[model samples]
Target: MGGDHTISYPILQAISGFRVVGAEECWHKSLTPLMKEVREQMGDGPVYISFDIDAIDPGFCPGTGTPEMGGLTPIQALEIVRGCRGLNIVGCDVVEVSPPYDFEGTTALQGAHLLFEMLCVLPGVQYSR
Candidate 1:
């Protein structure tokens, strides 16, 4: 969920078992389309999820190295992680949280929560409220 998005390219390549493709930034009100496309492509295969905190709006995730405007909201970020509920998520991570810049701890809190969300969705995890 954090760190350099470019790193995804190399990681995808290293896996060799999946498609090694570049990622395109998505700016929209909904992520369903993008998620659907990805889910279809994955087709029940084991997948690793990585979320960059920079994907959240700087107002919400200012601690990230690459803060961008018009990024996802904290709510949207949670939904994205939670949306993986039925997928074969082998493992996941949230990255790019720089606390030195997060004076109010908003970004760090969100990053930690997203990481927990990732864990909840992993295959065989017994999710609970």
Candidate 2:
């Protein structure tokens, strides 16, 4: 057994060299350009996008504890997801959802629905074991 090593684990200690490579300003810009860069860098390989719902504002998605204001709207998120339409999707996981934070279940519903929307885009997705 390993202790939070590799892509399978979340701690990401060995990933010290890993950079938080995108600019916050860029996220507000058109996603197509960034997606193109990602595609070019990936070079005809598989890509997995984890569309975390918490990336949206807490006003609209109030279940997450760390909800950032002025985040992407659902439509914007969908557009970004659709932009990755032709890429080979290996897998993805949307996380950081604290359903308990949303007393009325609003955030949980949005998170689940977003996951469903992602599934709609990924037809051959392997259900996690």
Best by lDDT: 1
lDDT of 1 by residue, 8-113 (tens): 6535633525443222344445665656666677767767777888878898889977788777788777766777777777667777888789899999988898
For candidate 1, the TM-score is 0.75
The lDDT values for all models are 0.73, 0.59
Q: Which predicted model would earn the best TM-score?
A: 1
RMSD after Cα superposition, model 2: 6.3
Model 2 Cα lDDT, one tens digit per residue, 12-89: 321222124433654556666766665566554556656566677777877776778778766666666666555655
State the lDDT at 85 in candidate 2: 58
